[model samples]
Target: MTASTPSELIARSRRLGADPRNTNYAGGNTSAKGTGIDPVTGEPVELLWVKGSGGDLGTLTEAGLAVLRLDRVRALVDVYPGVQREDEMVAAFDYCLHGKGGAAPSIDTAMHALVDAAHVDHMHPDSGIAIATAADGEELTSRIFAGKVVWVPWRRPGFQLGLDIAEIKRQNPQAIGCILGGHGITAWGETSEEAEANSLWIIHTAEAYIGEHGRSDPFGGVRAGYEALPQAERRAKAAALAPTIRGLASTDKPMVGHFTDSDDVLEFLAGEKAADLAALGTSCPDHFLRTKVKPMLLDLPAGASVDASIARLTELHEQYRADYRAYYDAHADASSPAMRGADPLIVLIPGVGMFSYGANKQTARVAGEFYVNAIHVMRGAEALSTYTPISDAEKLRIEYWALEDAKLQRMPKPKSHQGRIALVTGAASGIGKAIATRLAAEGACVVVADLDLEKAQSAAAELGNADVAIGVAANVADADAVQAALDATLLAFGGIDLVVNNAGLSLSKPLLETTEQDWDLQHDVMAKGSFFVAKAAARALIAQGMGGDIVYISSKNSVFAGPNNIAYSATKADQAHQVRLLAVELGEHGVRVNGINPDGVVRGSGIFASGWGANRAATYGVKEEDLGQFYANRTILKREVVPENVADAVYVLTGPELSRTTGLHVPVDSGVAAAFLR
Candidate 1:
């Protein structure tokens, strides 16, 4: 067994963090002590490299490693100001930095540095915490661990806890690690391989012990009427409640939400002790950081009607907020940070499942995952003995610690459109795609809705992962298809905020040459389609009680009265008027409707690529390939209006700069005096 490099430590961490059963997401730390040449003195210097704060071990990298001089870090032991002043050590780590300091050191830095080992791993695995949280955790650890792992009673993580564990290791020479009472676990060794193996041994041993001796039904068996409903009913109920729940959770600030109906959640929610354990809340620091001190549990059983559940949810929500504020008031001191938020991140319903919210989709999803891990911890602990967690007062201490306050202060500022959900029709290509891309770039979760499901999916993948964008199939001409797309939006990222009605096609023909089928097709997809999208979106916006935006991608032809374009022109005109009508009607509800008028978006356009380019070219007596330049030449500025230009107008209308300016048409055709909204 010998010391290793930072990469070795990261590799070991990734292996251990790969499974949630081993550690919760972003909830563990790993470290290694090594020697490197000092650049200035040309002498060897011992260095401590550990996983930095707020980073997931599974995705660790060189930049995510915090580097400090081992001697400087260990020297703090002499100046130790006791447990109350231990938090100051985190700020002191910056002074011990070997060079650029790398990433910010976590509160666990002392735990890794003070311990007498070349390699160490600290994790929040459910199985380990299950033993750790049991009422008789010390006795349980002695028996289940075969006298190898010691029990370090719960102490909020900081410098003092690290010193205590290091002393425990020195006293027990044969110990590999210790179960952190009411916390998690820590394992250490002389080498990377030894350290990782010891961690797995502890985690697996606890799991096996719980399996062999624990009760078969620790959660007190399933309660009648709390069992999960049929799949379809469950899904429908979730969709119906998601928007209202999202709005309530966003009382502090708007949040994106994630819903889970996994077997773990449903099973836990149906158990007789589900309400009791959930109310008791999570034990681990990482778990509570995301899940909060407690979840908002619905009083109704699984058999309750959707309407009754929603109605009761509103009442429970108010009580939850009041209780949270009381907790803050009881524990807050003059030095404590102002209450971060009163809204619960996790919400539980007996029949449906769990919903978690955060500033973004991935965050919201991760919060739910942390809560699931807590459930496992509770189940295992209850099987062994009475499940007990650290006191709420200690929780308040950690939650309001100044170090955490500084960490929050250091987070990157929110994007202009962060937490917004946008649904853009015809978003698979051209102007619609450009709009979706810009909205996502500005930090909105986008739904790429298009008739071509495959292309829509491809475009969404290019934008980003599920957190930023998702593709939904929809034919705007069909009302049911449009509703389905909106439904998908709700299920994915909660309620909708911005709706871009951009699905349209153009057919160039003289009044005499235009056929009845041509008129219907244009009207159906553009005029009626815009109406349906706005109507459905408005309903959701009103239900959420959150103001929103609806931007119609009308055409410059709507006002230009251009020749050989009667059907296409009429539909655009109809869309433009609908925007004005809706804007005036929905003003009271804070829903602003606007229109973007652009002329001749030829390149990369789905409509143009599908033969509208050649048709308009022939109608205007220009070559098919020259159509774009020809249209550009007709504009006063003589600049081609591409899809991106139209997208820019959409942002302006919906962004904060023009928030109060609704029902206004912005022309993106370089300069079309005839098409200007007079």
Candidate 2:
């Protein structure tokens, strides 16, 4: 029954981590004790393979495990210092490495190592914590498992805690696991399958106990006049307030945001007890690390007007920061790490649901997920008895733990556009798609707005999931559609930072051959469309009170006279002038307006694919296949400009390097002498 294979451990860990009911993302660790041939000694040595710090167990691999020598790990117990020196134990783990090691060991390393078992599973399942955080968690644990599961009081995890658990195991040979008070559940067995089954049994048994014995209304009845708003109204209100909230949250630094209005969140927010419970903060360390100590709850009743809520949020935010500072001052010792920013990671509005913020979109989204886990913990705990988490002093000690601070220091610096949200029109293909992809790569949340919803969605998916990029259907020529896109942008990532007006269509025709329809069509999608997008984006930028960038992807033909491009040339010229005009207008609001005039981007271009390439080639008396080469030869550099070239130019215009430069049109024409702006 001994399942010491590293592969089996990984499979078992993934199985548990995959289910949110088993644990949260990156919330728990799994380990196996086995014999392995040491690389240097070439002799079988007892090895401990445990999941390392800061990786999701569901995505666990052999490389994610920290391999340590069992002999060295056991020997440390003889020299064991008290709990006060627990952090030093984390550093000592490096010396215990079997060889080069697999990954950095987590703080819970000792907990897994000293436990008497061939296999171990530690998880933060909502059910387990629901019982663990109850006011009488020890009694509940005794009753729930009938002595099979023991109750361990809250002790900061380290070497001593591991010793305590090992002693507990020695005293109670029949015990399968222990419920970590105010923390989570830990189970062990000789086999991996048995360990997993034990973990599940503990979780299900706790859940059933709570479900049957729990109060019907865990959070009490819904508050009068605080019912949730209708779905559409709720979303609209969230959209309206997102920018204001984002701006406030970014007081210390810019942050991206995520909004969730799940039924669970809505129901919890509407409950009479939600505000008080949220004020008490979360029970699990995994929950608070991302969600912060306590969420900021709006004072206004549910369904309040958006304006009223907005006015009230400012005052509440001020109070939240002041309280956060006071908490740090009270508990943080001189040895503690510097206080992190005082902004609330989670903001709760009764009717509108929850808003979560972090350095990037994925982080923000995950923070929201953690808060939901906290909500579930509260529900279960309250249903069983009372939801009682660990003390603030304990939470602060863990939050400022030396090992955790070191992990933060080890993280890579933020990317250039980490907190930025960029909207690129006509982003389904060609130059627009390239710009969106480039922005996303540099860590910007992207909106691939296009006329074709399906193609836009595909392009956005290629960039990343909803956390990184989203497809938005928009016809920029329609002012309402432009506004809707901007509103969607606000809801998607809290607000917009970069606007790329790249939606366009080209019609190649001589003045005499140009019909009214051709002229109107080109102008509607390019010149007028650019204006609409800029106007809508400007409004959002001003509302958010965040300075941003507006870029127009014009064309070389706008400046250089080209035959058979009457309609296309006129439309592009219109877009070029609009850039200059908007630059002067938006400068007061700190919004920079710029343009890029690319020589040609025929390859993969939707505009060129839709008959424009052949039309322009025919007008020039050249085959469509040779048109690009002819254009390249005409340039001083004789380099063909592709979609990526345009993308690069766009990046330069909107990037931090050119932060101070605006009202300028950069050329991506490979030195097209005639196309150069005078």
Q: List the residue pairs that clash in candidate 1.
A: none
Give stretches of model 2 more than 4 Å off: 1-4
For each candidate, give its TM-score against the true structure.
0.98, 0.98
Q: What is candidate 2's lDDT per residue for 512-531, written digit by digit as tens? A: 98899999988999998998
User: Which candidate should be chosen as best, given lDDT against the real structure?
Assistant: 1
- Scored by CA lDDT, what does every candidate get? 0.91, 0.90
Clashing pairs in 2: none
Per residue, candidate 1 scores C-alpha lDDT tens digits across 24-110 of 888889999999767789988999999999899888888999988899999999998888788888889888888774788899999
Q: On a 0 to 100 scale, what is the lDDT of residue 623 in model 1?
A: 95
